[model samples]
Target: MGLLPLNYRRPDHVSEEDVRRNESSVEFDEKADASLKSGYSGTSPGIPDALTFDRILNGGACPPCTVRDFMNYLIYIEHAAENLQFYLWYRDYVRRFDAAPASETVLSPDWTRAMEEDTIARVQKDATGKAKKDAPVARELFKGTDFEKAPEARVESRDPFATPPRSSAGDTASLSGSQATSYVSQAEDAFSAVGVKQPFTIQPFRSEINRVIATYIVDDSPRQLNLSSCEQKAVVRALSYTTHPSALRTLSQNIENTLRRQAHPNFIRWSICNGNPARVTFARGLGVGTILVAAVGSIILTLSKAGRGWRALFAILWVLGIATLVAAAKGMCVVLHGLHHRNVRPWELFVEDNTTGLEQLHEGKRSFDSFGSCNSYEDEPWVVKYQRRFYVRKVFDREVWIQEPALRQIQDTIFLQSVLLALFGASALTAIFVAVPAGGFF
Candidate 1:
């Protein structure tokens, strides 16, 4: 009536051989544990000690990480730091430009005064339209004489005929052509005496003023983005012509506002969530799960006596699953698109389809010594092929790769995948229920 079987009884005494064997096993285990701990602490046979998760995460001074995990982490951190520095520099430059003394001239009184003076001069010149019109008559009358050399005193008395007073049109017309000629000559004399130059006009000052204003406006705006050297020179030249300080200050403020409103590059914000191994893994998992669910659902729907609606639903699920799987395989994280409000393709973030030129050489598609055999090929060792078959391409430039976006993209993709899985599960359950025979309600 013992709990243990009769044959399975404990030994009466411990054997020396058995004890020795047990002790040896314990010693071996201890040695193995020690070796493992040592391996983790220092470099292993092939793997470097510096390529640890801790060292990379902590940003410590470690050797080059050959492991993808640490390598990606380092790359991301380096790019992020660089971008941060650039962004800070740009922001500071903008601030300094705004605070600079030259920015105050746009709205200064000098600009207004210059504009007013130019306007008044133009109006005054325009008002002497009648005098300008009479120039032709004077030039014709004084055609033969050096009227320009008329003496300061005798110029007024040089004309013999005097202009008849305008009383009535009949009286004025009554004067003969000689009398009219005499009147014109007298008028010319009077004009010369008064030092009124022929072809009366004023020189243009607005063109120079306008040019200066344009230059100051350009100078006040951010120059680092896309403004060219030629454009900068033009702007400077324009500002040089400007005499108004108020106009310069106003233009400067306007430029500042424009720069502020512009979407300048942000390092920290742009670098978030990129080159994250966890994210890649998660994306892959979701993609695989979706594919499996879709496959199962499709198989069930095909074999079961389900209605057209259910079949169609399962078919759609299958297609969606396949699509998700492809995207995951390519490392295309759709969530990034949603969060960033932009299209973030998979190839931009990860190196995909990495292959060596060996295959091409073997197939006679490329030469063995060809340096640039592939479009993605680079001269660097790190840019080499992976697995002796796949050529790993470099990621996009840091500036192009990162973007400013909230972290919502992470949740968006996860949530979408979860919902899809749930639907698949529900469909499977419904199919199962429908297949079952209708028994009693109890």
Candidate 2:
């Protein structure tokens, strides 16, 4: 049975005649095949597309790879939830600030080079211990192109995405809206200074800015972001003057770069191992098969009148097999992880949620009247949800060919230092086997 092309957009007014006519036409099948090929093997068959990084940074990156998808991994696996959370908030924050009336909003002066100030430098240099290790690497890779400065350049470009996004909205959370009037929680109240007067220029968004600082920009914050000491101070200092998006854009540039460089690639590699047809097969088949055979074999030999050397040998094999299974599960091969490279696999492009917004935008149910003349809502499109790869059949899928690396290194290091210690264990087990002479002969 043929599947609908992933990029297939359901037309607004599809008559019965068109469906019957298209079903019989060979052109339908050809188009579907071509689209699938581009997604799997890149636009040019076998040559990986260079747009991978750019797609990831912008919304609607490599299909199945979206803000929702990455959020799960970053929050659970990496323990760096604050970066993506702050980035999402900033995008929405900036969107609202942009759509606000000129009379209400005021632009702040350049807070650039704030990181270069002597106070910030001293905090970074003197920062030792876990603070130094956990500190965010300064933003460079995605500089200038990021949304903090130029939201239009990347999002507005006519460049084709891995999957076409339905629409974008100027859903800026304006202060005049219900959000500003909503009851301030005790936590939010802590963000504002009691006696100090907020700057009159940015009176509209001063509360929101203070809340952002308390949650993401301040030291000892509940969900503290990885801003340098001086960077944090700079954001606070700039806010005293203006409440423009640029005022705290150091948050934008830094967090965007951090997630793109670190969390994104890791998420991709994870998807490859977990979703790729071949990798899944290799993991379940070989990974499980090896575990059963090695474990059973080791147990049988270990209980018999086997020599210590023989038992030890099987034990090593058993450990190595477990390592292989683990690596397969993580979709990490030492070479690829070390090299920081991955292959784009078939059926892995993200599928956008097309149920509501797109058809409405086309059919006149919802308004998409801005940003390349799109998005009806205040912040983003109503139906911008991204779906992961859909699986069909998996028979004779290719090999993942994994050998896990981290545990292997740890095992080696521990074994080398603990070799003498291991001897004591070996001797203890050897004596137990001797004391309880095996019924079965080797």
Candidate 3:
């Protein structure tokens, strides 16, 4: 028999304190019944006679369904209105089943064991381990496993009008470039006949948005760089087929337009933060570099026989470089921040580490993906209290975080500061060389 969640249990012939301790649970159950009566029901047609958040999250004890199965259903539904029903059920279920608004409902050992066993069983069943990351998109906040690195089992093509495959041995033959070009022209003509001129548009990015503007906008196109067409297509495809298709399309068009204006290896830098390139310059970097070099040169000149004007120049540059380094370390680019104040939020940035940072790398492995947090999620857990009772909010309790960019922004901010500090150190060394006499070393 399935074990009942703590909230569903009643105070048998136990002490009054036991009942009082669980008073919030009774209130929640009543609220849940009221919610069901007042037009709140699970997304399914026939509402289960008894419904609870535990059932919605980890599957019902009655039907014995896991939360994983429920999520899988949502994935299949995609954008169907019925999926919205499931979303509502989850929201209501959480509000009603929680023992207290603030107290974190720790998963019982049996429940945790069940989930772990289920995960392992599912993994073992899939020969390719593809199902491991096949999590439902909604409530992606719960962390059982990181599906980001799941096996590349492609989604079955749903388009009914896909082109038929042609083999060389069959009636179809491989077309030369010229032949392919001719066919494309014919297809274009046919498309024109049907009044369709490639359903696409280039969305322009206003250069005044963020430093991304300076990073991506110049006077030439990115296609002229050594990047392959395949890379472009990959970026385009990811942008097009995102969960937020419309937003991705808009972002991609904006990126494409931005690329037409400049070429920067660091284009992805600004792109990652949804920042503009035209506004960001090496100036932030240059400021710190100048200060470091000047300070170092000044010290060297004091020891040597350098001229006054040159010494003053070195000192000024050194001070400026030091200030810039400090600013970057603190993520303070006042001018750029003011210009793109609305677009850029003060948060951490998540950058992937391939290797060479930790023991994981020494073990011949690397992570192409990483995540960050506002406050340490691992350190301080969030709980919602209901009427002086405590309950863990499921959204914060689970390990996985679905709000990807928001958390990553915070991490990135921390990383950006570190990088600026390093840049300052390098600038100081360079200044010492340029301003100080080389004879001192001899």
Candidate 4:
């Protein structure tokens, strides 16, 4: 059977006073049998475990008797659970990796920035002084290097589409200088065809270039220091993996857990209440009005010589009134509940072990799959169709449903109650005066 909202206000047949009075009169065996029948094994039958019940009872404001209150309480619990889970995950992470200096240094942005600044300052101080002294000599030496010549002027061929000649099988450098130049021209032409105006060039030694400049200025060495493409890639890969065992997986799991916890409660609450103030107030009024109408109609029908059909109609009215009262008291929409079974989390499972709790909170693991799929009316099963049609309003092109204006909701409730009252009065009056005196069916 689906989980139903408990009516806390409704007293069981045996009240506290009655239980106290009958305590000594009842037999122990009878009491135990009664508990067993109610589905209780050890303590109170049908009641959750002591700790779980206590948590629910103390959860907040008696689970809210109205839709608006229920939704607000659910939202509060969800947000609180999420914040608590995040705090726990962070605390665990810090405790687990506290001894690792590299982890701490990598995680802290402030520490990383401070280390970078120190390295840059040391490099500049060592290189600047000698570079100023050897500026003229360094400039003269750089003139002879390839860096001083234009790329096109140095090439033997101006033709951009030229291809390299096939080399002899024994030649060690398969593509010689001329062939290499031809290949470079072809690549440049290809780049230009795709709208690139600059020549295609590979500079896989940015860090090496900086190091060489620093070395030339400080040590006054004419030798250039550079890493090949393969060497540069290897160095980069090594640097990236310096901090192994990434916290990404752990952090992602924590985030998923947080969302799961919030989603379950929110889905259950929405399924039951839908958080429409107008609808809640209207339902409450209709329930009360139905009961009052039933009472008046019953009295009139009893006093009159009404037919079997009229008597049966009164009976049906009484049943409808009672059912409406129950729904109103629980703040649940009967039509919605019938369509979608209640699949609220059990009281004990709310604080289940972290992993178990997270699994339960997950949408896929939910008993009612419709909650996961149909977030809005556009999706399947149409769970929220009625709510969307009546309660929602467009504000700035976005639909707003909850927290409608108090005056508007009140007005709607009053109109509904007035209509019910009018119907009840007319029916009662007609049955008593017109139908009774007619002497037959009518």
Candidate of highest TM-score: 2
Clashing pairs in 2: 63-349, 63-350, 64-350, 96-172, 168-375, 170-378, 171-378, 171-379, 172-378, 370-374
Give the residue spans of candidate 4 off by over 4 A: 1-275, 307-309, 341-442
Worst 10 residues of 2 by lDDT: 169-178
- The candidate, 2 or 3, that scores higher on TM-score is 2
Clashing pairs in 4: 40-45
Residue-wise C-alpha lDDT for candidate 4, range 184-274, written one tens digit per residue: 3433332232222441122222222223222211111121112222222222222222222222222223233322233323323333343
Clashes of each: 25, 10, 48, 1
Which regions of candidate 2 deviate over 4 angstroms? Answer: 1-64, 107-198, 275-442
What lDDT does each candidate get? 0.34, 0.43, 0.30, 0.34
Candidate 3 overall lDDT versus native? 0.30
TM-score of each: 0.27, 0.39, 0.23, 0.27
lDDT by residue (1-442, candidate 2, tens digit) is: 1222233221123233443354355231335534432543112111113224344445544333545446545644565666666776777877998898877764444444443354345533434332334323222334564554654464345435311221222111101111232223322332242112345534667667766655554434546665433454445556655677766654565555455444555555454443354544454466567556755665676667775455545444444445555554445432333333333332112113465435433523211111112211223333232122223223222233223232233223322323333344445544453455444555
**Which residue window of length 10 is worst by lDDT in model 3?**
366-375
Candidate 3 residue spans exceeding 4 A from truth: 1-92, 98-278, 285-306, 329-331, 334-442
Error of 4 at 379 (Å): 28
Global lDDT of model 4: 0.34
Candidate 1 segments whose C-alpha is farther than 4 A from its true place:
1-234, 238-293, 300-442
